[model samples]
Target: MRLRKPKLVLIDLDGTLVDSVPDLAYCVDEMMKALGRAPWGEETVRGWVGNGVDRLVMRALTNTLWDDPEDDEFEAAHPIFMKLYAENTSGRSCLYAGVVEGIDYLKGEGLKVGCVTNKAAAFTVPLLKAMGIYEKFDIVVSGDTTPKKKPDPMPLLHAANQLGVKAENCLMVGDSMHDVEAARNAGFQVVCVPYGYNHGVDIREAGPDAVIDSLAELKNLLK
Candidate 1:
């Protein structure tokens, strides 16, 4: 079934619009090296993403998704990761297939478009610009843009507020359970893409309103 046409559309960044794992992994491995540990590589780093830089750094330092590094351990490595990531944010990142087409289609339909992600504002804007899609988004709400990020719904709700749209008039397109939960809490319709990082769990298990293989498929569902 087609979803109601929403006044504002919020898309996630990292795993959804762009495959930033290459860049993130590079930084993660380098950070590990800086801390006198071995690199986790791209495939390993891919699963640790979707949270923000802080969590990603902690995961890299601890080498587990669930474990937390001590404050001193985190403090020692977080800055290294941040510096490394700041230098390589988009060097190897690329937009996913159909991203440009999908965003263009939405713009053609006159819908206000936005990007919401747990990534910090420091990295989000630069990556979007580097990927050549910065102009496509009318507003962007990064993890730090609002007081809280995804899985809490503050970012989505903040994006809606910035776009001057009501919760019911917004739709969020993302790739993880955090997206689904956030959209639900924010009272916005949510859709998921299969290819994003979901910590090895199937995104379908998260029960988004629907799942599409590509952003290009979004238009087909939105009528």
Candidate 2:
């Protein structure tokens, strides 16, 4: 598919630009251990992602102890998870293959690059800084930065507005249903990556404008 030179490009963080499951799983394990619960495997934690920390913690608690965590339990676990996660932010995290070159190529093409992620700003900032790509984006919007996250289209639309671009002139690149749905709702083009986590669902089934195995393919498609 040929894409017009985008005035703005909005990228997702987790499971899109970066493979953050390792660090996420580590935090989940640590949180469970703090609660005296058995640890879950990485694959199990992978299935619990994409929703948000509250849902992730609840899912992890349910999987490990066979009981859903109440709001209070999750509240107690939240800070512990954050503390452990902040310490291990980049311990097991790494950018997806070709993500660096892809972003660089887009920037070189004069596209206004931005990040719209469901991750909280606190975690998102440090993670991007650790990955050494924090400066790549002209704007970064986190899940908590807005009243609503992806699937609501507010964040994507908001980012486009912030970049002084129309939604139709922006491209939203991500690896999950939330991304596709948000872009679709916001009247932007959407691209999906096949290798990222999508709650065990095939990303292709999410119905993006295109599905790619690597971000490098995006350069060719856009060109």
Candidate 3:
């Protein structure tokens, strides 16, 4: 997508900046073991990511999108997963290809950069900091930072407001449809990376403004 030098660039955390499923999968399995359920494995957990921790736990419990775990079970499993995730966050996660270069390019171009993610603040903040990319961001708006998370447009809008930029002048970059839909709903341009977890669906079908393979390539596109 062509842009006239967006005033702000809001990026998604998981699947975009970080391939976080490794730690998430570990936590999911640990939580499942505690609950006496079978481990979902990394492959299954990969497809369940991008939504949120609660949804991921539910998906693990049900093993299918057509069904959901009971609320009581969810309540029981939620904290277990949270505790496990908190202990494991970023321990196995790493940045995706070209993430650092891309963030550097954006900052080098004097663009205001913010990290917007469906991951909760408790997990999001420390992970970014642990990865040494936290200070690179001008602001961070996590899933719990707003009333609603991605696919709701509230988090993106909240980031824009925090950065003092208008939604129309902001650009959203992510790896899933939630990012694209959130950008669309918030009146911002969006680009998607093909490598991220789009809930096991093709991100192209979601129709982002641009489909980029690597974050580093954004340097050439941003003007």
Candidate 4:
């Protein structure tokens, strides 16, 4: 079968573009320290990511129990996480292998590229900038940039709108079920990479249009 060329490509950040768990875990550790709590491991932080900073903090604070915190506690913790994350944003962060080349190849093919990540804007921008790939995308929509995040389809739909592409003409590339579900709901095609944070679930179980071992393989699909 002939492959289709997407008019627009929407991508996820954490676990998709960058293996950002190190820095994220550092922030979580810092926040926990500030609150007089024990620090969690990097693996724990990876499972907590792919949602947003608030959810990540909530997960970290609850030690993976995912319990709901009171409004005041959540409010206080949010800024602390943000502050800690901002301070250690790029210290140990790096783009996933093949990500830069894949994005460059997509742009060379004349496709509009956008980022639709659940990471908050404050963290997203600095991380991307530090990776030197912030300018690669035509648009960057963070978790708080829209009313709804992934699995709601609103963020992906909004990204499609910004790229001037119909949802059906776009391809969403991410590492989590949230991206697949969001794309499915928005009527866009999707492909998932195996090496992303999928909440400890198998990425194949998420049921994306295609599963690739590396970002570079994406070019073969477009061939």
Candidate 5:
């Protein structure tokens, strides 16, 4: 099915643009090991992503999705994760199929593209650069970039403003509910990729405007 086109499109960084779990999982595991805890393997770490580094680290520490880590515990562990992730950000992360082509098609159609993510700018920029897709976005709104991040609509709205496009006239393509909710809140169209992480749940349950198997399908779905 074809979907309405938008003036601008914002992409999510972690699960949407790249499968950063390998590196993220590694860092989390390493940090856990340093803290004298058993490592949380990549499979488990995958479910804890999409929020942000702070949340990810907290989840790793508590071994639960919603519980908060103790102040002293979190303070000590956060920096260890920061260092581990920084030194190995994109070593194993990779772009999914057709990411480049789909992005190229959007630019070819004269659409403005931006990257919005709950990740800190420090890791987002380097990861995108390492994946060779950094220059593709017109703007990047990170977790720390605005007062709020996804699922609250702040980052997406911020990007639309930076790109000089109306929020309702933009599209958000991502993998998780955070993307779907943010787009809905921001009054933008939304699409999802089935292959990306969605907290171990199917992305279709989030009710995005469309769910495509590949990024290349943007050419088929969009105007």
Candidate 6:
């Protein structure tokens, strides 16, 4: 399929630009410990991400899809996880390979860019700044930026609106079904990477416009 040249690019945070699960895992485990619950390790936490922190906490607490933790228990654990996560956000999180070069290429092409992630602004902003990519995005749409998050398309559409670009002229680059569904619903093109979390499913099953092994290859595709 022929791809449109994007006027703006919206990128996902966790599992797309940065592998943030290590720090997220640490916070999840810490929160569990404080709650007198067994800790879910990093590997398990990897599959529970991309949904947003509250959902992540829910998954960590329940350890299965049937996450019906007691409200009081969840409320107490939530703030603890938030505090630990704020402290651990970027210490072990690093940009995946080719991310920097890809960002440079996007900028060189003069495309407006935004970061739209389910991660809350409290963690997203500091993590991006610490990783030296905060300034790369013209706008950063956190989970709380809009009333709804991915798969609903509000955040992606909101990012395009903020960049003053029409949704059809935007491209969303990410690694999960959430990104693909968001871009599709927003009327934007989406490209997925093979190596990131997709709830333990193959990302190709989500049917992105293209599947790239690394962000560096995006330059060639865009060219």
Per-residue CA lDDT of candidate 6, range 95-125, in tens?
9999999988999999898899988899999
What value of lDDT does candidate 2 attain over all alpha carbons? 0.87
- Summarize candidate 1's per-residue lDDT along 85-157 as a digit string, tens digits: 8999999999999999999999999999999988888999999999999989999988888887789988888
Steric clash pairs (candidate 3): none
How good is model 6 by TM-score?
A: 0.96
Worst ten in a row by lDDT for model 2: 61-70
Model 4 TM-score (2 dp): 0.94
Candidate 1: stretches off by over 4 Å? none
Candidate 2 TM-score, true structure as reference: 0.94
Ranking by TM-score: 1, 5, 6, 3, 2, 4
Model 3: residues with Cα > 4 Å off, grouped in runs: none
RMSD of each: 0.9, 2.0, 1.2, 1.6, 0.9, 1.2
Give candidate 4 regions above 4 Å deviation: 1-3
Q: Regarding lDDT, does 3 or 5 come out ahead? A: 5
lDDT of each: 0.91, 0.87, 0.90, 0.87, 0.91, 0.90
Error of 3 at 195 (Å): 0.7
User: Which ten-residue region of model 4 has the weakest summed lDDT?
Assistant: 61-70
Which prediction has more favorable lDDT, 1 or 2? 1
Better of 2 and 6 by lDDT: 6
lDDT (Cα, 0-100) at 58 in candidate 6: 85
